[model samples]
Structure formats: structure tokens, C-alpha cells
Target chain A: MNATEPKPTEEILESLADAKSVFIVGCSGCPVGCDVGGEKWVDEMTAAVRGAGKDVTGSALIELLCNKALVGIKLGRIVEQVTAAEAVLVGSCGVGVQAVGNMVARRTVPALNTICLGDYQGLWPGEERCGECGECVLAYTGGLCPITLCAKSLVNGQCGGTGDNGECEVSPDHPCGWKKIYDRLKELGRIDDMRRMIDPRDARKRAIPDAIRRTTRYALEVSEQEDPAPASEE
Target chain B: MSKLQQQLEAGKFVVTGEIGPPKGTNIEPVLHEAEEYLKDNVAAVNVTDIQTAVMRLGSMALCHMLIDRGIEPVFQMVCRDRNRLALQSDLLSAAALGIENVLALTGDHVVMGDHVQATPVFDLDSVGLLAAISNLEAGTDMGLDIKGNPNKLDGVPKFFKGCCTTPCSPTPEAQMIKLEKKVASGAQFVQTQAVYDPGAFENFMKMIEHIKVPVLVGIVLLKSAGMGKYMNRSVPGVQVPDQIIQRLTDAPKEDRAKVSVEIAAEIIRQVRPICQGAHLMTLGWDHCVPGIIKQANLT
Candidate 1:
């Protein structure tokens, strides 16, 4: 499932300050589990938006907000109310919010901040996944993603600040990600995988940047092809 | 080679000191303390970069100033503030300025610092940073030559590369594994997180027997009993035993500094036989380094 958290109340209110009417779009997928972008969450957000004295034109909880076709058909059901609203407040992952923004002509504000995972989630509910780093050392790491688990996103190994209880130094309550990798590798009799030094993650090799910018890929590709040298008389 | 590296190579029980650059331009007092108290006693003084993630005068400038004052500085570069390009450029700058020792760290998360709202740039973890240093030393940057070849550097810079470890981590194997990676990535030396337990340190040293780099045990001077208790409660992988805290608590208010020095010196004595050196992190008490050195008979 996708992980999402609500934007701060002040930030959400400030972004919607100029709009008198707001239409809410909630994702029934991952956000439901997070309790921030589901049907219940949309209802709470509607009241909260109404509490701020803005007129909420309508609210719709789409089964998968990230699915652009579903969002298009769903918005079609409430076309007049969606058009009447000055802005659409999306309670979904960044992908879903972008989907809503693409379909609507009005201002689309995000109510939630999408949590990036190392591994892109599929239909299964497991927490771990590939971080999209160019190099896949999962076989060596016992299938644990250090990039996703470690607060520092250290791929080589654990940092020196691991807590006394095998928790992360940044968040003591969470178990150290590298420790989990070590335990899993040990159980599999592949502890030697932890021995080799994982080279510095080449950001050039990382897939996240390209994945995020795919929507604007054509514009980026055109800009890369065009040189900005001015024709001048010497 | 840096004096610290030379001493470590010569099998000398080298002692290093740490100093944090101030938040503003009024850096003379801290520099003066280092020059006066730390310059001669320690092999090299580490200038912390935005230490504890608090924004401050950059470590490179302070390190250069230390050089101006005839004191060698271990330029501590944390991967918390700069991206890879900036980090690589700074490494070249440190080398150009004649700063020899470089300690790479992942750095404390920004949440621990004064600028909690600041975005942390972990573009490179410590292992990656250490590798970057190694790459720069090999006359290539972390980037390519556009034709998929390693980019050549204008001039190669040599540094006594160092990495840090937490000796008493709950997951010792994880720490050890990272230490091995750091060494493999060209960490010529290691300085650990503040370790109070001599017994635990001995065990850690034994565990890392395969890593040939000289290790300097970290000893952050406990300023007071309250500080020790605070560390025990809040600081990770750092446990200050009760007897030491009790000693600090019982020491008459005037003798607290002396007790702290004595305690530090005692720990140094305990760990000296197993480790190569002691890294005295006096925090703000620079004057205590000389006293600890004298008490530990490392003068």
C-alpha cells in the first residue's frame, strides 16, 4: 500500500485561503490504511474545511485515485459541483493528486504528502520494496532494502549512531534497518553479503528522479536537445 | 602525511581533540582555546561540520584557520549539508588549503539540531563519502567524463581518510560490518562515537581485529552528573555507568571538572592497551585535554 501523511493544518488552510469553495477527492487505496486519504478521512477533511467556513461543493472517494481513468469517470459523476468549486483538495498520494490536477482546470491543492518507499508497492501489503537505486544488491542484502529502512538511507551498512536497543539513531522506537538486514542475512547463511562494500549510490543511476519527472519528460528532453548559445557578431 | 597519520603509522598512541566551530563570526575564542589548549597536546584537532547538524561556520574555514595558527585540523565533513557535487568540490578545496586529515560521517539528522525544519541532504552516506575521497585521490571524481569514463581531476589530493563507529551498539555485527566497509572504502583510520564502557570497548576492539586501521576510542568529557544522566536517557549507544555519575554528583561543585578529567583519564588508561589512541572530545572544556593527557601519562 502507498504511505501518505496529511499536510500540516496551517499549510492546508493557507493553500485554500483564496478559494471559497473546495471539492475533496479521496483515495480509497493506500490512504485508507494511513487514515489520511480514505473515505472516512475525506469526510473528516470536509468538516474541517467547512469548519474553516469554506463552502465544500462536493466530495468523492475514488477506489484508486491514482488511476486517471477512474478519477475522470468519478469526477464526471459530479461534474457541475467539481466545476463550481474554486479549488480541489486532494487527499491522496502525489500520483493521485497529480491525476486530479491533470483532469481539473481549477487549482488543485494536495492535502497529503506522499511517503516514498525504496520499493514501489504492488498489490501485496508487505512493507519492503526496491528503492530504485540503479544497483540492486537485494540478493546480497537478504532482500532487505537498506535505502528504505535506514533513516540515513545508508546502503553500505548501518551508521555508528544505532541505538542501544538495535533501534535507529534518528528514531529510537524503530528497529535499525541494517540490523534487520544483518539478521535476515544471518538466518539465510548469507552473512557474507554484508561484508562487501556497497559503492556510493550514484544519483545519476537512481530511478526516482526519472520516475517523478516522467510527466514532464518531453519538455525535459526538448530542453536537453536545445542549446542556449546566442548568435552574436564577433 | 598528516601528523595524526604519521603518529598512527609510527605506532604512537596518538591523541586527537575535537572542536566545534561557532554559529557566527565570533570564532576567535574557540580557536584560541584550540591553539592554547589543544594544539600541542593532541596530534590533530577535529573541526566539526555543522556539528550535531546545528548551522555554524563551515568546518573547512575553521580548519584552515587552525592551519594558519600552526595547528593541524582533522576536517570533519558530514554528508548532512552538501550534495555529492558540493561534497567533492569541498574535498578538493580542503586539499588545496593543505588540510590533510578528513573524517567522513553520516552526520546527525537535522531533527537533532537547532534547525529542525532544515532539509538534510544525505546525498552520500559516510561510506560513499569515503569512497568519493578515495576516488578524488585516484584523480577521478564521482562523475563520469560524459563518455561513461571517470572524470579526471585537475590535481590529485591526498588525505589521511578516517571513519567513525559506535562501539557499543546493540547490533554490534551491523556496526562491525559497516566498519569493514569503511575500511574497504579506504578508511585509513577510525574514530568511534563516545564510549564510556572500557569492557565493552575491549570486546569491540577484539571484534574488529581484522580491520588493520588504527582506532581512536572516543571519550566525550562529561561536564556534569546531569549531563551524564542526560546522555544515558537520550544519547544512543552511550551509557555512563552509575558509579561515574555518582562520582560527578558527589564531587564538590568546584571539583566537577577535575572529576570529569579523572574519569576520562581513567577510561583512557583502561582502553589504551587495546586501542591505538584516545580521541578526547572535550566538548567546550578544551582546557581539560591537557589535564587528561597528563593524568593518563600520554604526554
Candidate 2:
């Protein structure tokens, strides 16, 4: 997610402009810990909507957006409320926005800007961590993901712009990812790793296509539970 | 002027402020802010303990830090974090260190903070904590066994205990009951939650005219219409009127800060005559406080 991309602000304003009732849905996953898409964001958003002259019916927080089973059970109750209202505002990650979009016929709007997927660093009071490149190079970088660190996202060698004091030229406080890598290797008694010139990274692995997929454990669980017999037994 | 001395000899209104400790060991900035308020001639500075359920450097340590800087700190001791023993120890330490002022509060729930699963320790509510402080002042712990003999702590430093009240509660009767309990539990002063509408504060003052303790009106600087509404919804005691929200909305983005200072100054102007003093909750808008004071003609 791009940090600057504004989320569904216009959608929220239009949907709730004349609405008599609204229900805010918050995600309990990524945004919860980051203090953005979770219940706190919902609370702040709900208050902002009410402040803007709208009647909020009530709000609820869901555990995970990708959990279709939980969403199926929970969305029905929320949809019942939304049916009476003009719109439903979602304060969740991009996944939550899509889930609610799919579940709630065509009415609900999203309030939050789905920024990124990093922990709350407090630089911006309520912004997400965005690791742009779709590559996980933590193993080679000594657990510090360089994709988010290096200003240029250089995977091979240290940039000439690295300051003598070991801070990045772009942001002095932020350490150069390559410098960090060099220091970590030196501490591990493996300085030779930096002396050898490494080849360029495979660009295809880092190329993020337009659409992402949820082919992980959450999607697998949903597909395996197509038959609801076991749920009935439980 | 010393806070107690100002309270004793009052002509001009007294000004008090709150400092929310940062959520880490990095307290230099927090201390710098406290020193700034102290330099501004504020009667007292309140150091909050785990405010809004967020953990920070404990109030006891921060209070000592303020005292070390020659600022009189009103140490805030919430019942949500510590039990009776820890509470008593902290109180004794406060008294020993000459940090006399104390504000007793029933802290926010643990779920509201960063660590949700952290167990809450609400062994005693605010009133009980006040009663415990009174007991400690009387030289007896909660167990009623005197350390050396009966009434031994008479020579220890005394605490100026305070409590909080929500002036804009939907139900005044319920609020009055809580206020009465606080007064009965040995609270000498009452600091209220944010008061946006002066009319509500006037009505509340009329309702509690019989209360003998000094009432300090809380004045929070409005950052935005969104912030005001958020506090009204999420924070338990605060209620910002629709007109204030509209004023903030109508204000241009560049002039919103000016409008906020103006609104806070107006609130203080309207309520100063009815209360003992005004406690400004800058909400991290520390730089605006001196401006608010000047605009309100409080200096």
C-alpha cells in the first residue's frame, strides 16, 4: 500500500451525508495493533461522522477480515442494521474493505486510508507501516527488511550517499540498510560476505502485480469448509 | 507562587495544567514540557499515571522529577494500576519527597491501552484510594496496625488530596452522588473533565453549590471538529456542544488553531467566575497555552 494514497474519504462523506443510521466495522487484525483500522479508529471515525451531523446506529469490531466463516456469521447481523441505514463505514485494512464490499450489497463506504503494514512507530499519529517492494529480504539483511529501510531500496551494495556517521542521506536518523547489513555481518565475524560483489536481485520476485491474492491459511480454511456438516455437528 | 500558597491567598485565579507521561523511558521531553509550564507560572502541574489506560513512566517517579525541577507536582494516583500496598508506598514516598498534591482517579480500563490482555489491578476505586491516603496521613496503614505505635505518621508530610468530577454528565444526579462520595472520602479539591459549554458548567455549579471543596474547571484545547467529537464519544466525561463543533467546522484549516485557542479562552472566561481555577488540558498543544492565557486575560 502506498503511504500517500487517500482511502475512502469521499466514499464515507457521500454515503453518510443524508443517512439516518450507520454502523462502523473495525478490523481486529493489522489495524488493531497499529491503532488505525481497529476499534480505536472506528471510535474516532464514528465520533467524526457524528460530529459531521450523522446518526450512527452503533459500531462493532471483527476479529479478522479474511475469516469468511466469522464474517458470514457476523456480517448478517451487521447487514441487518445496514439494511435500515443509508450506509456502513468500514475502518479496516484493504482486505476488510473488500470483504464488506462483497457482503454488503452495494451501499457501504470505507473511511480509512489503507496505508501500509508496519507496526505503529508514532512518527505519524495514525499511519500504517508500508513495505512497498513485494520482497522479503530479511534473511539476507539480518532481520532488518531493507525494502522498507533503504530510500532507494538498493538490494546489492551500500549507496555512496551513506553518511560517514552511518545514517542515511535521505533521513539522517534512519540507518542505511546496507550499513546495517555490513555491521551485522561484521558482528557475526562474516565481513567477507560484504567484500564479494553480489549479482543483481531477481526483479520479477519484487514486481507487485495489480491484484494480490489471499492464498494463505485463511483462504485454505474457507475452501475446506465448503460443506457445513462439521460445523452443524459442533 | 507556590500552589498551596496561591490556594490559601487567592486574588487572581490560579492556573493548573496536566502532563501525560510518554509511553516509554524517554522522559526528558516530558520533563522539559513540565519545566515550561512551571516557567509560565502555573500554580501546579499534574502528572498523570497511566492516563487513558496507556502505560508510561509511573507518576510517582515523574512527580519526583517535577519536584526536583522545583515545580510543585500534583501527583495523579489512579486505582486501576496498583493495589493498596503499592498505593500506600507511593503515597508515603510522595509525602517524603515533599510532593503533597495528589489527584485520585479511577483509571481507564486496560482494554483501552496498548496491552489489552494486561491484568487490571483495581483493588480500590478512587474514593477508597483517597481514604487510604487519609489513613496514611493519620499514621496508620490499611491494616490499622501502626508502624511504631498508634498515630505515628503525624509528623510525615501531609497531602493535598484532589478528585475528579464530570460536570457535563447526562445525569446530574448520578454525577452528584459520585462527587459526594469523593468529598466524603477526604478530597479537598475537584478537577472536572473538559467543559465545552459554560451553561452546563453553570448548571453543574448550581447543583453542587453545597460542596465545600474548591472546583477547578477543565479547559481542553480543541484541535479539530473531529477531535472534539472523538472525545465526546470515546472519552466518558467530555461533551462538546454542537455549536462548538460547527464553529470548528466553519473555521478554515489555517485558522482552526486560532479558533481552538479562542474557544478555550472563552470557556475559561465564562467559567472562571464560578470555579476556583481553570485546569488547561492542552492535549499536546503546549505552545498554545500561553496564547490561551493571554487571550483569556488570565495573566
Candidate 3:
């Protein structure tokens, strides 16, 4: 997640506005492990809402909503607990929230404004390490994700705002991502990779649209069962 | 009695302040700032060790510098970069320097620092560190053996050990258990994390009334509304009420500092009865602490 991006303040405020009984759901996926929205976050948000003079019905943390089996088990219990609540506040990433919405009744409200898929790393409180662009270019940049680093997210060239200190004009504390990519390349003795011009990123491929389906072996089994057999005619 | 013990026994409204040392060898500014607090006659001046996971001058060395300047220093020992041997050695060094007061803490993780490559040595957690301190005070090392034939300096070095507790913990039961462990490990005084809401602190204090040690409520001067929100989101067990944030937001740019001082002073004024005293974490704004103390009528 973008640590600098304003936290789920607005989402939390909006979630508790007209709701008395609230159920908080935490995500145990990417952002959660990095300290954004996990079991600790769920407890913190619950206390915050409760301190605001509202009754929190109950709270549950799902391990990974992307996993069908785990989601099925956890979401079943979550739906039951939140059944009596007026609203549900999910503290997961955007994808996790969409998955939960698919399984649950259409009343749960998302309390977290899911930012980017990344790690927050810096001396100061707010610094994100990764920005999950669908394309992977770590092979050229010495394992450093340049898509997240470059100020303009430029894949080919450096931004015009790079200063002597490698900091972007937009923010002095933040290093120009492209400059870091160049430095890392030089350090790894692979400066020749910098000469390779990159093309524009395909937005369609990068866009993580909601409700994605995975064609597992179970799908193949279902399709085989759907086919008419000679034994069925007998 | 030690100076801190004497001060506490006299029923004095103890005033302790924090000093964030600089990173480089240019220690003039740090010493100057520390002297400023010392000149104010604060009961004790705490020299922080690796605050916010950023490396700086060692707390033991800085505390020694303060002691040499005739100022009582409370050396903060965090279990982040040092192993048990180093921790024990540092504690022994502090005792050797006659620096009695210590604040034990489980330091921030390496991921939170600018130097992520640096290895984090969490040989012993805060609880274990506290136990080590207690053992040191009992004239034994971590191996439970007497040091130098057990007759060194008439007895074991007595330390006015302190540990931190967060009043804004999600569960008071767990927080109390941790606090009790600290107390059981020989914490003479408990310094809480930044406390913004009096109601929350009151509830936490009520839950831990059985612990007999004095609880020093941490009073952090709120810098800005954004800062309040940042702390609320990033740091666990630190909840800044929206009203406080709004108060900061409404203040003019130049008056923000004064407004923060007033807010901290007001919190201290209200919480003095419940807590022994306030541990002021000025967050590099030490000059305003005197003003806060004055405004709060804390003698």
C-alpha cells in the first residue's frame, strides 16, 4: 500500500456514521502482512469505532479471500456474525473486499480505501516499496521494481525532475525511482540494460478488475460431468 | 535513596523530558539541547536510543555526557540492535557511570528504519531484558552467577528501572498482563506511550490498579492534524481523538506550536490526579516543554 496515501480515515468515518452495530473484517493477504490491514488493524479499528460511542457486534479476520476454500469457510462465519449488524467494515485490499462482497449479502461496507500493492519501507512513517504493475521488469533492474520507483512510473527514461541528490522535485524525501534503477544497474555492472528502450505499459493487462475466475481442475470436472454419456441414456 | 527515588519520596511532581540525539559525530547541538533541559532542572533527562529505528549516538554515552555535565540522565535501553551480552554490558557500563534510571523497551523493527540492511538482534524481548535488568540489580549476570565474588560495591547496583505501557491498547487485559510482567521483572515505574484521550487512559489505569509502581503518563505535544492521523494509523496503541486533531486543524500555522503546548498542558492538568506525573515526549520540540509545564501548573 502507499503509506503516504491518507489512511482509511474517510472510509472509517463514513462507515460509522449511521451504523450502530458494526462488524470489522480484516484481510490477511499482501497488505496485511506488511502492517496495513490485518488482525492488529482489525482490533485497532474496532477499538476506535467502539471509542466513538458505537456498539461493535463482532469482528473476524479472513486469512486469504483469494483462496476459495479458505474464503468459503471464513466468509460463512463472518456472514453469520454480521447478519445482525447494520453495516460491515472490511479492512482488506480492494480485491479482497470484492471477493467478500461476492460471497456475502450486499450490505457490507468497505472501510479501507485499498491503495497500491506494495511494501512500506522508509525512515519516516509513510513510505511504500512496491507498486503492483502487472508487468514484471525486475530482470533488467537488478530485482528492484522500477515501475514503483520512477517518479512518473516511466519504464523507458528518467523523469525531468531528478535532482543531484536523486530526490524527486515532487517530494524531497522520496528518491526518484528511475535514478535508483540506474544506480542499482550500475552497482550490479549491468548498465547496458539501461540502453534497452521499454515500451508503454498495457493498461488492460495491469488493471486488476473485480471478480476474476481461475480455471482449476474442478472446473474441468464440472464440464466433463455436464457432457451427456451413453450410460445416462440407458 | 537514588535521586529519582528521593524525588518521588518527596512527593514532587516529577518532570522528565526526552532528547533525540543527532546521527553524526557533531554532538554539539545534541549536548546544547540536553543542557537546555538540564538547566530547567527537570527531574531526569532521557537520552533516547535508536528512536523510530533510526541510528544515532548511543544512549549510554549520551547519558554519561549528561552525568558529566552534572545532570541526572535516564538512559534508555532498547532491545533492537544489541544482543544479550551487549545489553548486559551496556547496563553494567551505565551502573559503572552511576546512571541509575533506565527505560527498557522492545525497539522498533529494522523494516521501519532507513537502514533496512542492518541486522536486528532481538536476542531478548522487552520482558527478558527487564528480567536481565532485575538480575543485574540483584548482583548477578544473565547466567545467574554473582559478579566479582558477590561483594562488589557493598551490594548489587540498584536501578530505577522503567518500562513503557500503552494506554490506548485494543485490549486492556493483554496490556495489563504485559504491564504486570514488567512489574514482576522489577520495573519501579511505568512510563506509558503517548496518551491523548483521558477516558482511555483512565480505563487502562483502573484495570492495572493492582500494580503498585507509579505510572508516568506520556504527554506528546501534537504537531499537526496530519501527524495525529499518521500516528493513529502507523503506531499501534496510540489513538489521537478526532477532536484533538480538529483542534490542531483549526489553529493557524504559526500558532500550531502554542496550540499543541496548550493541549498537552490541559491533558496533564486533567490527568495529574490519576497519574504520578507526565513523561513529556516533545518530538524534537523540547523548548516548548517548559512552557507546557508552566501552563499546566505542574510544580
Candidate 4:
């Protein structure tokens, strides 16, 4: 799932200072595992916003805050509470905040900086899994991503700035992306494959892709497909 | 016919040279180098188009200059700078200007160049471009224009188009698949990335044994052990064997250039029979060109 973390309460307060009343929103799936968005976290946030001298008009632990339909149905019931609040505090990823904003047509303030698609180690952010750049070149360059991991996103070849010990020159703590790719290709008995270059991605090929977008290749059915509605009476 | 094309047709061991366009309007640097290549009996000189993403004089201009001087020029076209229309226009102009032997390439990404801020307009990849070039030759368009001017153009360039290949890829099958696509798209020949390991290149060549197109192995001169290591660590597709790195390291700086020439000559001798030709890339060390050709005795 798209991983996220709770913004520092102080940071969220900066955007909420002008609002006398606020509504809290949180995600049920990823943010729950991430510890930033859950029933307990929503209560905590309500208390904090209340402590900041703002009234907690209403709040909900959204099943998936990024889901427009679920958000519409849930927020539709809380129309009076939503209108009473000056703004919303979304305790999920940026996508969730944007999704909430898109659904309610109200100001949605993100309480978390959406990080990479993550493997949540704990409630706090730890690791990034996928970059979601539309193209997945993981098979060619080991299981890691040079696009996000490497400072220079060098695809065709590695920059000549590598230190001999196989550490990234830009970040000493991080393992060099190209070195990792080289070693992985070597281990896979396919070192010669590094010679070929990945073509530049067509930025227009994939639009702001939703759950079940179809492309020339396989359809990426990220969400469950629903059966077609019975044809309308002629 | 272009000298490179003629030599390839004759089944001769071809030797092509490289000359980057001068960054400024200085025409002398390019002309002087072209004259040197001609004197060295270089079959053709491949003019780079903003190689390494660095801005330079257009390859087409230098090519025209060489053509006027009665020299064969292989025009290098990269997809990084131009969209399909501009690319197709240049292709037609290259043929109309008597420039044959075009090399289609997906140039270095813009971030690697001085003009990092410039937007990259890679409307097509190398394989896509080869297909476009073939379509252009077939009296059709790249299908980029939607208005359906599907009628044939008044003039079309019959280019002896070639494309670049990475012979020593980590995934040989993937490389083969793309190479097959390039050939299918009407690429007449292919010049590979600089090869250092004979065994690796041999395996790649073996996989590509069925293809009838000529494969000219790229040979970039290695000046020192440090450079070799740098390329090994950073340069994609190009790797220097540890032994060669050790060989250069064992030599003093004064003799490193000599050792480099000798090593290149040896590689040329070894791969001369296996491949169609040797594409000698004199990466700013043009003086060593004569010594390499003479030592290798490549025609």
C-alpha cells in the first residue's frame, strides 16, 4: 500500500491555526499498519486539535481515505459536521488527503507527508518499496530501484564517480545503486544484459492511472473488477 | 556508395572513426580531424550529435562539410533532442544532401549534459526510430502526424541506416530481442558499445549468430587503469576486465598511452575476423588513431 506517516502535530497545527473547527480523517488499510491512521490515532488527533483551541466537529476512520466512492458515502452522511469545520486534517498519505479534497470539495490539509510505497516496519516510516514511476525495471537492475534510490537515476550506465568500496558517493550510508545492479546481474548469470538501455518512458502513455487501467500489455487489475451491470432495457 | 557501406558490401574489414562536433562555431577543429581521418585511410567518420548531451555544432553541418571535401560521413541522429517531425525532416535532409550511412541512437539522458535544464524530447526510442527510418524509405511517414497526409512524399531518402547495440548486456536474451527488433525495423548494420571482455562479447555474438546484418564492434581506447576502472564501475554496457586494468596499472604513466594503443591493437586483431568491422572511437585522443590502425593492420 502507499505508505504514509503522521505529520508532527505542530506542523499540522500550522495549517489549522486559522480554523476554529476541524474534522479528522484517517486511512484504514496502510495508515493503520503504519500507526498514523486508526481509531486510536483519530482520537489522539481530535484531542490534539482540541488542545490547539479548535473544536473537533467530527471525525471518521475511513476504510480507504483515497477511495472517492467510500469517501463520498461516508462524508455524505456527515455533511453538517463537514460544513461546520473550516478544514480537514487527513492522517494518511498525500493521496488520501487529495482524495479527501476531491471528494468533499472542502479544504483538506495533509497531516502526513506521503512517502514511497512502503513496507511499514512500524507506525513510523522506514523503507520504500516501489517508486510507481509507471515503468518497473526491477527485473533488469536487481530488486532495487535506481530511479528512486540513486541520486542520479542513471539508467544506461553508472556514473564514473563510484568509490572502490561499492558505496554511493552521494550518500555514504546507502549502498551504490549501480554496484548493486552489477552484482545482481552478475549473480543472475546475466551480466551482459547491462549493456542494453531502457528506452525513455512515454510520460503520456499512462495517465493519472486508477486501480484498473488497461494498456497495450497486461491489464493491471490492482483492485477487484466488478461485473458489468445488466444492459439497460431497450 | 558511402565508403563504409562499400567496404561492408565488399566484405572487407572496415575501420570507422569518430569525431565530435566542436562546441562552438569553430569549423577548423572538425575539418582538421576529418582531414586526419582521410589521411589515415579511415573508411568513414561518424559525426556525433551533441554526444554526452553536451551542446555542440550540429552533426549535419560537419557531415555536409565532410561531404563537400569528398569524405564519407556517417551521420549520428539521437532521439533525445527532437520530436518525430524534426527527426524525420533531418533524415530527409541528410539523404537530400548526399549523406548516407545514418546511425540512429537514443542519446544520453539530458541530466548527464551541461544543459540539464533542457527538456528531453524522446518521441521515439532507437527501435522506434529505426522503424520510422524504414517507413520513411518505404515512402510513408512516422504516423506522428494524425491529419492523414498518408500520401507519399515528393522526395524520400534511401538511407543505409544503422543502429547501436550493447553486445555485452546483463540480459543477453533481452538484448537479442531488441536487436532483432532493430534489424526487423530495417537497420542494415549495428555498432556495439565498446567491448572489453572477449568471452562476454563472444557469448553475445553467438546469440546473434542468426542475424545477417553486419556487427561492427566498438573499440574505445583505454588510456589508463583508472579510466578502465571508472568505465567498469560507471559506464553501462562497457566493462574493462580486471587483467587489463592490472596491465595498465603495472605500466608507468609515461608508457600508459603506448600500452593503450597496444591493447587496442590486440583487441582489434582478435575480434577482426569475428565481427564485420572495428569502429574506432578516438575519445579526444586522435593522434593515437594512426598507431592503432597501423598496429592492427585493419583495412
Against the unseen true structure, what C-alpha lDDT does each candidate score?
Answer: 0.82, 0.66, 0.67, 0.73
Ranking by lDDT: 1, 4, 3, 2
- Cα lDDT, model 4, residue B252: 89
Which CAPRI tier for candidate 1?
A: acceptable
Candidate 4 local Cα displacement, residue B249, angstroms: 2.6
Q: Which lDDT tens digits does candidate 3 get at residues A1-234?
A: 222111455545553576777777776665454475677788888888888777888887776544445655776865667766665666644344434544554334545433322222211212223343444444344434555565345554342334445555445577766676666555545555554434434443344323222334334544554666557554
What TM-score, computed on C-alpha atoms, does each candidate reach? 0.73, 0.54, 0.56, 0.61
Lowest-scoring 10 consecutive residues by lDDT in candidate 3 chain B?
Answer: B144-153
Deviation (Å) of B272 in candidate 1: 1.3
Q: What TM-score, to 2 decimals, does candidate 2 have?
A: 0.54
Better of 3 and 4 by lDDT: 4
RMSD (Å) of each candidate, 1 decimal: 15.8, 22.4, 19.9, 17.2
lDDT of 4 by residue, A59-151 (tens): 988787656677778989988888788777777654455456556634566676545332222222223333434444443454345565554
Which candidate number would show the highest DockQ if scored against the true structure?
A: 1
- Which candidate, 2 or 4, would have the higher DockQ against the true structure? 4
Q: What is the lDDT of candidate 4?
A: 0.73
Residue B40 miss distance in model 4 (angstroms): 4.4
lDDT of 3 by residue, B165-200 (tens): 867755444356556767777788877888999998
Residue lDDT tens for model 2, A1-234: 221122455545654565667777777665564456655677778887888878887777887654545665787876666666555676654445545644554344545544332322222212122243323333233333345555544444343334445655445576666676666544544443333322223333334333332435334544564565564554
As for TM-score, the candidate ahead, 1 or 2, is 1
